[model samples]
Target: MQVYLVGGAVRDTLLHHPVVERDYVVVGATVKDMLDRGFRQVGKDFPVFLHPKTGEEYALARTERKAGQGYTGFVCEAGADVTLEEDLQRRDLTINAMAQDADGTIIDPYKGQQDLEARLLRHVSDAFVEDPLRVLRVARFAARYHQYGFDIAPQTLSLMRSISESGELAALSPERVWKETSRALMEPHPQVFFTVLRRAHAMQDWFAELEALWGVPNPARWHPEIDTGVHTMMVLEQSARLNATLPVRYAALVHDLGKGLTPPQHWPSHRGHEKSGLKAIKAFSDRLKVPNECRDLALLVGEFHTHVHKALQLKPATVLKVLNRCDAWRKPQRFEELLLACTADARGRTGFEQTPYPQAAFFRRALSAAAAVDVQQIIADGHQGKAIRDKLEQARIAAIAALNDAD
Candidate 1:
């Protein structure tokens, strides 16, 4: 069977980008033929096989037809008869539709190379609108390659807007949406992902909490950006610059959901947004089936970010209370992530992009001081049960007090 390298490997190579994985499309291979050739069948929905020697994925050249709705509503057709051009036509983007033969000859029936050279992210065909997931995928691609000056083709963007307005986005599973969103969050310019979704009118369907923030006002004294949505995007961008983890980035993303609930009459002043954000964060986490790590960090940042910002003025007991509420001593890594999220939030406002965050250092030092309290010494002094607990708290409080005094 004739085999050709396909999809991401080909596309990334053309852009002089690193190829993470190599996928092959067997142009003339049947499922039975692959099975007889020692390739193990792996895909449940389609004829995908693992190469016996290389162990890389080798999917038979296939074409799909719209069968219903959402991403899964498709009938895939694959066989020895499917042509490379036909298989390429089914891809979501023109840049990803190109393939390469064994002799390294580039196949460009859809002119993917031309689009690549033009720095345009154009869809392969009218069939692009058939899958709702393509909207997120395109947005994600924009986020990933925006640094390279890539922009979506106007026609493709119009199609994305159409897909968003067609009510099909509602059929997409939460898991699928989060999958794209989480990946997008880790990109260099994650803000573009949300911006593209908003442009397509798709944010309300999946990210209503975030969409609600677009017009919401915050105090210009603190947030010159004023728009809560703009602040959120800036926080996300700062989190990326800090090389934060997924949980930290996700926390920064949802940290200001409470601002969206502020009464318009209170204009520019959201007094209790920190705690008010918990409900919205929980709803988002539950709806998306977000992992516990991500949800926990998001909740901490949502409910206590203001406390971190006001740390210098808070009493030692109050600071200790904040630490205990976040379980900082027990889960030190998560606590650090919370601090990063808070730092991102502080730096996200207008004219604050490069501002130093001394609050983060203060919190870290306070945590270290409190965490260093000698619990074993209290136990050794015959303190037990309630007495030992009381002594430990007193020692931790003393340590935090010492830290504050030193500062």
Candidate 2:
């Protein structure tokens, strides 16, 4: 049997990029042949094994045929007769279809190297349309390699648009969709992922709330980038630039969903969008089974991002009230993430990319002063049950007032 290093390992190696994992394809091998050589079978749907010593995956060279709907509805053939070229042909992108031999000789049957040099993401074959997941995969690759100036080929984008129009995207599992989305959010140019998806019309089934923002108007004086969708993408870009956590990035993404719900008559003025956006955030979170951390932070940012933006002008008591509502004392880290999301929003507007967000630092100082209030002193001064809680609130508010006065 001949083993060839395949898929991402080969592709990244050619690009002089860091390889995270190595997967091998064993051609001219049977299941028994792998087992006899002390490899452990791991893949449930196909013949994949784990090397006894290295513990890396070693999947038998296999070919697939579309048998039904969705990504999972496929019949696989991993017999000894399956050639390396046939296995490569079944892959989604040309760059991902190339393989390398044990002697480090590169194999480029589908011109993956040529496409790589062109900085283009092209499909391996027409079989690319068989799996709907490729649409998200291509978008993700676009985001990941965007820093290197790579773009999706026009023909491949046309196939993605066809897949989007076919209603096949709805058959994909929510978990899988979120997996790709969350990973894409962490990429260097996360905004490009959604842009590509929107371009391909892939947002109708899952990201309709975000898609609705494209044509929506915002107050030009405040937004500069009057299109709500443009501002949201800018926010996502700023979040990545700040190197914020995943929850913060997610919050930045959905902070303006309320703008989508604004009546056209209101035009440029979404008076209650902060609270109006909570519904969209909840629907998105529930549909995608988003983690509580991400969903909760997004909800907080959606409901109170405006309050954060206007922090410098608010009364000390109002600032304290916002903090209490956000449960800042109980979950300080989440509160910090909310501030970062808000900061991203402040910097996301057109012509404000490098603008400083003093609101975040002000909020941090206010939180620190309020949290430093002496609760034990209030309890020691003959304050009773309800009175102690009341006195603590009053003291915290006073502390915030002192901080505001100093500012």
Candidate 3:
């Protein structure tokens, strides 16, 4: 069997990044051969092996057929005649289709290197329109590779538009959607994500709640930005500045998505937006089968929207209690990520320049102290802990009422 380095390893080599691990496609080899050669088999949908010495994956060169809809439903054909060149053709993007043999011979059937040189992400073939998931992949690639100065091929972009309109996206399962979306949000320019998808009219299918916000007007005094879409893009840019994680970044892009779904209201009277964003985020998150951790994060960011606004108006204790209601407060680093996203949300409005929190240290101290809050020391067992928790909740409501009362 001939082993050839494929896909990202080849791309990373050209980008001058350290190719830490390599994925090999063993052409003209059977699973028996791989096992005999001390490779461990692991893939379910396809025949794949792990090298005994290096533990690196060595997947057999194979072809796949769409036996059903969704990412998990593909049927594969891996055997002796399935050449390495054929494996490269089935890849989503041309820039990711190159392969290099062990001796350094380049297999350049798709001219991926040329496309890389031209800063272009083009499809291997017209078959790209068949996998609706490729639209998200392309959208994420546009975001990640934007810094690399790569341009998506015009025809490829057009195909993405076609896929969006063909009900292909509607057939996509939630987990797949979130997988791509999560990856896109973690990338450098997720704003280009929606921007690219919008041109394809794909955003309507992927994030319809956010799409509904396309032309909604914001209060001129606070939102100098044209519409919700513009505000989202600005927030996306700032979220990247924070270099936030997939969930945090996803939350940032969609934090205000609830605004569009609510009834028309005047400037800043958002009486129930936190609750609204949570509802929307949960609905979308469930459809996407978001992990429990990210689902909690989405709920927190949605709830955090209200907390940050209240923090601007009242006692820090009130804000602390509100933040405590969120699971994200449990994360030391993500707390700062929350504030960064919140500040970006504020500044991204139509007419504002956000000031970095001067009270950042104070808030950290407050939260840290809250973390050390021991129930047994405070009183006793379940009775005291439950009582304290209830009291805290009541105190938070009173503080919020006071703010509204003052207003």
Candidate 4:
């Protein structure tokens, strides 16, 4: 049996990137052959085994035939006769289809190395369109390599657009969609993920709220970009630059959905957009079955981002209200994430990218001062039951008021 390192390990090595994991494609190997060698079988649809020593995966060289719909609708063919080239042909992208043998000799039946050098994302074969998941995968690769100036090839982009229009993306499960989207959000250039999907007209299939924002107008004074979608992209990019977490990046992406619901007459002024956005956020989050952490942050940013932007002007009571609404005392980290998301949004506008946002520090200080109120002292002073709760509120309000005065 011949074993060759394949997929991401080979591709990352060629790009001078650190390889995090290694997988192998074994040609001329049978299930019995692998089992006899003490490789533990793990794959349900096809032959895949964990190495007896290194614990890395070794999948038998195989080919697939499209048998039904979506990504999982495929019949696998693996045997001792299957060639490494045949297995490579079934992959999604040329950049990921190359392999390396045990002797470190690179195998390039599909010219994946050439495409990688050109900073291009090209499909491996016509079989690329068989799996709808490839569309998301290609978009994710675009996000991953965007800093290296990588772009999807025109022909491959055409295929992505065709796939988007074929009703196949809709067949994907919500969990699978969220898995791709959340991973994309964590990428260094998360905005590229949505940009690629938008270019292919695929956003409407899964993110209709975001898609609707593309042509929608925003106040040019506040958002120099004018387009809500452009503003959202800038926000996502800024969030990444700030090293924000997945939930923060996601909040930055969806915080402006309310602006899309503005009436035509309202034009640049979305007077009650903060409240309006809650419905859109809920619907979008529910559709994707987004985690509570992400959904809650998105909801908080949507409802109170404006309040955060006006931090310097809000009364001490108003500042306390915002803190309470964010549940800052209970989940301080989440509250910090919300502030980062808002900062990203504020700076996302053109001409505002590098501007300092003291509002973030102001609110953070407000939360700190309010949380520092001496609740134990209030209880020790004979405050009890409803009186204790009232005294706590009074003490926190006084503390926040002192903070405002000090500022």
Candidate 5:
């Protein structure tokens, strides 16, 4: 059986983007042959193998059958026994299903090449809904593919809406959902996720709390972006342009998540929405299969936002005391995350503070100023805690704030 490169590697190569992962499909190969060749056998429900030489993944051409519902409903029989074309039919997206032969000729039985040329995202087969998990994949795909200006097929989007209403989406594992959402959030522009899911009516169910931000009013004079939802979209979009990682992007996307969940008041009373949002984010973290670092980061960002509003009113020492309690301020990177979130929040206004990003570098200056405070410094060294605290007293307020302006 001849093996060929497939999926993202091929798509990225075509797009001239950096290719990160490599997956392949083996045509005319069988499970026995793969095992005989020293490949590790995996996927009980779905057959797949790992190459011993490259340690890269290699799957044989096979088809799936619907045994239940959601993403796990089907089973696969892969190996040299199946044709290369058969494997392409099973992939989630057209752009991902296309294969490249050893000679560099693309083997696209599903017209994925055409779709790629047209900058469109299409499904491989009618069984697109055999597992509702694909709907999330599609939405995630839209989020990334938007950089290429692609559109989801109308019929495909209709299927996603139907699948969500059927409650099959609930059957999906939180980890899988989180995995997909996390990847999508990494895209340069994630609002495509909103555009597709919103049009398909799937957003209301998948992330109902966020849907509340759809038409929420902004202070207008400060926020032209309007409600918490529109601001969320802007936050996610701007995140792509920043020097942040996956966790920071996610925190930014959901930084104001609690604003919509706030109790209705004559005016938007974010009261304890920050704390409330933390609780919500934790539950969401559990569902999205977010890593501990990301979850903790998100929790800290939400918790920090809850307390940040009080920053302008507190003395730097008292502010330092409060900031010291947080794990975020413990790391320089995490500190930047808080600053980014605040900047994103500040940018949701109509005027100076209400744009998509901060103006005059306010958050950066605040972060630089915060860095001067010694509360997070190594306190005790070899000495005991109280002694360290006493020794640190020699450094006064004026002394520390001076360091902030030095740079």
Candidate 6:
């Protein structure tokens, strides 16, 4: 049996990128042949084996036939007769379809190298439309390689649009969708992932809340980028620029969902959108089965981002109230993430990209000052039960007031 390195390993190698993992496509191999060699079978739906020595995956060269609906609705053939070319043909993108031999000879049956050099993400074949997941995959690739100026080919984008309209995306599991989304959010240019999806009309299936933000208006004075959707993308971009955590990036993404719910008659003014967006955030998070960390942060950011933006003007009591409501005392890291998300929002507007966000530092100082209040001292001073709690609150508020005075 001839084993060849395949998929991401080969693609990344060609792009001068770090190869994190290596996978192999074994041609002229069967279950018996692999089992005789002591490889452990792992794939449930396809013939994938684990190398006994290296522990890397070794999948038998295989072909697939669309048998039903969605990405999993496929019958895979992994017999000894299956050619490496056939296995490559079944892949989603041309750049991902290339393979490399044991001798390091590059295989480019689908012109993956050419497309890679051109900085284009192109589909290997018309059969790319068979799997709805490719739409997300391509969008993710665009996000990952966007720093290198990579873009999806027009024909491939058209096919993605076709997949979006085919009702297939609805069949994808929420976990799978969220997996792609979360990974995309961490990419170098996460905003490109959503923009590519938006261009392909793919957001209506799962990201409708975000999609609805595109045409929504915002006050031009506050958001030089008057389009709420544009501002959100900018926020996501700024989050990435700040090297923010995944939860912070996610909060930046959904922080403005309430703005999309604004009545057009009120045009450019979303007075109560901060609280109005909490439900949409919950619904989006619940639908995607988002992790509690991400969902909770998004909810907090959605509800209090405006409060954070106006931090310098808020009274000390109000500052303490915001901190208490956000549970900053119990979960300081999430509160920090909330501040980062708000900072991203403040800088996301056009002509405000490099603008200062003193509010973030102000909130940080406020949290620090309030958290430094001597609860033990209050308890030592003969304050009992309810009185201790009240004293602690009063002391924290006083600490924050001192911070405000110093500022």
Question: In candidate 6, what are the lDDT values of residues 62-139, reduced to their tens digit?
Answer: 899999999899999889999889999999999999989978899889999999999999999999999999999999
lDDT of 4 by residue, 272-388 (tens): 999999999999999999999999999999999999999999988888889888889999999999999999999999999999999999998889889988889998999899999
lDDT of 2 by residue, 1-407 (tens): 99999999999988998899999999999999999999999998999999999999999999999999999989998999999999999999999989999788998899999999999999999999999999999999999999889999999999999999999999999999999999999999999999999989899899999999999988888988899999999999999999999999999999899999999999889999988899999998888888899999999999999999999899988999999999999999999999999989999999998988999898899999999998889989999989999998899889888987776
Candidate 1 pairs with clashing backbones: none
What lDDT does candidate 1 reach at residue 19?
89
Q: Tens digits of per-residue lDDT for model 3 on 1-407? A: 79899988898798775575888898989999999988899998799888899889999999877777655557889999998778988899987898998799888899999999999989999878778889888888889878889878999989988888888888887777887887787777888888888888887765787787777766666677758778878877777776666666677777876777767655334456677777888777777787776676666777776566446565755765665665434576767656666766766654455545544444455555555555454345445647877765555455445444554
Clashes of each: 0, 0, 9, 0, 16, 0
Error of 3 at 4 (Å): 0.8
lDDT of each: 0.93, 0.94, 0.75, 0.93, 0.71, 0.93
What's model 1's overall lDDT? 0.93
Query: Each model's RMSD to truth, in Å?
Result: 1.1, 0.9, 4.6, 1.1, 4.2, 1.0
Q: 227 in model 6: Cα distance from truth in Å? A: 0.4
Instruction: Give per-model TM-scores.
Output: 0.98, 0.99, 0.83, 0.98, 0.83, 0.98
Superposed by TM-score, candidate 1 places the C-alpha of residue 91 at a distance from the truth, in angstroms, of 0.5
C-alpha displacement of 32 in model 6, angstroms? 1.6
lDDT of 2 at 216: 96
> lDDT per residue, candidate 1, 16-84, as tens digits?
988889999999889999999999999988999999999999999999999998999999999999999
lDDT of 3 at 53: 92
For candidate 3, the TM-score is 0.83
